[model samples]
Target: MTKILAVRDLHLAMRTGEKLVPVLRGINLNLPQGEVHGLVGESGAGKTMLGRVILDILPPNAVVTAGHVDCATTGSQIKSGGRIFSNRGRSGISLIPQDPMTSLNPVKKIGKQMVEILQLAHTGPPRALQERAEALLAEVRIKKPKEVLKQYPHHLSGGMRQRVLIAMAFSSEPGIIIADEPTTALDVSVQRRVLRLIRDLQKERNTTILFITHDLGVVAKLCDKVSLMHSGMILEQGLVSEVFHSPSHPYTRSLLNAIPRYDQPREKLAPVAEDLQSQLIDEARKYDQQRQV
Candidate 1:
């Protein structure tokens, strides 16, 4: 498989008052063409921040303090707030943010919003644009594309809104799609449906995906490779099978052990020992050293 996106020694931090809060420490990742990689971590683990870094959408106060992000074709390293990039790469990157309700514009009709998005990325005839938007809606499995097109975002269900967001991301036909907590806002049933939609679409389009979620179950079902993150660092990464069946990192073992097992009803989840905290800190230092190499 061809390499599409490569993140080498990527680091991001926020300047808060007198202290500097480092959120992403010496992160490195590689996404080959047509591959799906999952990033798993709990809240404040810098998972979302990592996604934002790839998209060049860091918070106002945050900065990409170190490292480079190389786009496949250009071979140019784009730094924070720098313009060393273009939309020349195969199927420009797109993002499906965490929240569906707030992601869409409240006043615009779904169809209109979708149309504008497509038009911005596509330079073509008017008739073709409308047809493309409608087709995307259908691809996302939204029923009655025409009727749904006329409805506002507020009129649609949470699941439907997420579908619209997914459709919009794919509207650009992106080569690399970053979906952050794609199913977090929906009910369990809706979550399954949405995840299935994303997985099917990725396979059909041969799109490279960076799927970010805190749920181990979701990772097991959708991802081919897994990166286990904790406290702003990748604790472990490898093939999903290896990571699941024979996890090497202590943090990874704890994450798996914390999962509820159907066979053991009375068994309590194993707690991640406090001693692991120092290990993570040491790992972070090691990661920082690797960044300098």
Candidate 2:
């Protein structure tokens, strides 16, 4: 399969006071065309940071110390200090943020937000954009999309808000989407529904998604391939089935063991071992030292 996006030997850091602290270290990732690739890691494991790097939306203090991102769809290679160009007026890559509440404008009506996104794809009259917006909402399975459009972000439930974001993401027909823990804020039932919706949309449009999450269960359900990240490094990556059934990395095994298994209802859930954590931390420190040298 052809790669839609690729990151090679990427290193990123943040400036805290006068010293630069490393966030991502020697990272390499590839998203194949029309596939959902999960980036699974605990919070602060640099998963979200990697997504932001791909989106070219890093924080002001963040610095790309090395490497480059290649977007095959755009035929553009963005180096450490360069900007990434979008396909159309809008980005070839879009983001479905973690918190819908914060992502949507509380003051703006859903219709206005939707139209704003549609406008980026093409120049059209208000009515045309509105119609496209409605169609997009409907595509995401939002009932009475017109009514929902007239409402504000707070007017809808969590799931509905997420659905609206999903609609907006696909409105421009982006080639790749960075789904940054998109279902984390929703309830279990809602989460499942949202996941199904994402899968359906991806299949219909043949969109590639870089699904960032800490949930192994979600990865197993949704991802074609998976990358296990820790301390800003990719510990292991392969087909979801292979990784899940035969995790070669100790960290990957620890993560799988930590999950609550329905089959082993009586067995106690195992937390990631402290010793293993220490070992990984030491490895990361050593990597940092080597880079400094």
Candidate 3:
């Protein structure tokens, strides 16, 4: 397990009127190659922002006041946006965005879009490229792969489009991929299929993945390591077994407690107590202020 990606003391903020509202506070992460690391947190905890920063696709208003990202495959430390600006690390980090419906072009045929993407990371005759595209679709377990190749994004179901996105993400054979809750919009069965496909392809490619989601079940099923985030900070992170089996942080324990277990069916899901949530935020603020010293 070689170190593939490392994020150190990362602090990111967004512009709000005349102020910079900090979103990621003193974040630190280390990802070994060929592993799936889960980033589990409630919305607005800076989970997606972390993924965006790593992929160099942060929003236009984003301000990276501090921190650096180190990728072993890209040949240098990424202190800022130089790698993405210079096209050095662009091809090495791919993203399977949350929305497959919008990730692909609505007007372009799937084959054309896929071909263009494949050409970014490969080159050959047009026919060969098309064949490779279809093969990728097949690899994701889409039936009638050739027909899918000729269709438009709107013509396919949400699940099919997601599978195509997964295929495209791996087509680049990138060293790391950020899957930003790719299953959010899908039904239960479709989500399972897509998760299985992603897990299988990840194993096949041996690519490190930053899997962002709030579902403990998904984390347990797909991730090797888990980082429980809250208020833009990692409250706890360790092996999935250790984190889920015995969560130490109050927030982490509350998150696990919120999950409904079939083994011990509950009348109602136990939301994190309001007082506990407030205490967690206070703790995060204290930690953030400490880092400023």
Candidate 4:
């Protein structure tokens, strides 16, 4: 399969005062066209940082030190040393943020927000934009699209707000989407429904998605390929089935063992071992030292 996005030996760091702190180290990843690739890691593992790098939304203090990010969809390449090359005017990327509550504008009506997004890729009269917004809401399976459009973000349930974001994400028909822990704020049942809706939309449009999350179960359910990240490094990556059943890295195995299984309800859940955590930290320190020299 052809790759929609690729990151090669990417290194990123943040400048704190006079010192530089590494965030992503020697990272390499590829997202094939029309596939769901999961980036799974615990907090502070640099998973979200990687996504931010791809989206070119890094913090002001962040800097790309080495390697490059290539997006075939946008015909653009972001290189180290602060060089960016683009072949098109608009980046063919969109984002579905983690928190739906804060992602949408509290002061703006749903219709206003949706039309604002549509206006970027479309130029038409108010009625045309309104019709397009209604169609997009219906596509996400939202009921009474017109009524929902006139309502505020606070008036809708969590699930409905998430659906509106999803609709906005696909409204531009973007070639790639960065879904940053989109289901983390939702309940279990709502999470499942939102996942289904995303998967269905992805298949219908053949869109490529980079799904970032910490949940192994969600990865198993939604991802075709998976990467396990820790301490700003990719510990292991492969087909979801292969990685789940036969994790190659010690960290990966430990993470899988930590998940509670319904079939083994009586079995005690195991946490990641302390010794292994110490070892990994030592390894990361050594890597940082080597890079510095």
Against the unseen true structure, what C-alpha lDDT does each candidate score?
Answer: 0.86, 0.91, 0.87, 0.91
Residue ranges of candidate 1 with Cα displaced over 4 Å: 73-76, 80-83, 87-91, 278-293
Per-model TM-score, in order, reads 0.92, 0.97, 0.94, 0.96
TM-score of structure candidate 1: 0.92
State the displacement of the C-alpha of residue 67, model 2, in Å, after optimal TM-score superposition. Answer: 0.7
Candidate with more favorable, higher TM-score: 3 or 4: 4
lDDT of 2 by residue, 241-272 (tens): 99999999999988998999788865678899
Local accuracy of candidate 3 as per-residue lDDT tens digits, 76-160? 4655444433465567778898988788989999999999988877879999999999999999999999999989899999999
Residue-level lDDT for 278 in candidate 1: 70
What is the lDDT, from 0 to 100, of the residue 55 in candidate 3? 74
Q: After superposition, how far is residue 230 of candidate 1 from its true place, in Å?
A: 1.4
Best by lDDT: 4
Error of 2 at 136 (Å): 0.7
Superposition-based RMSD of candidate 2 using all C-alpha atoms, in angstroms: 1.3
Better of 1 and 3 by TM-score: 3
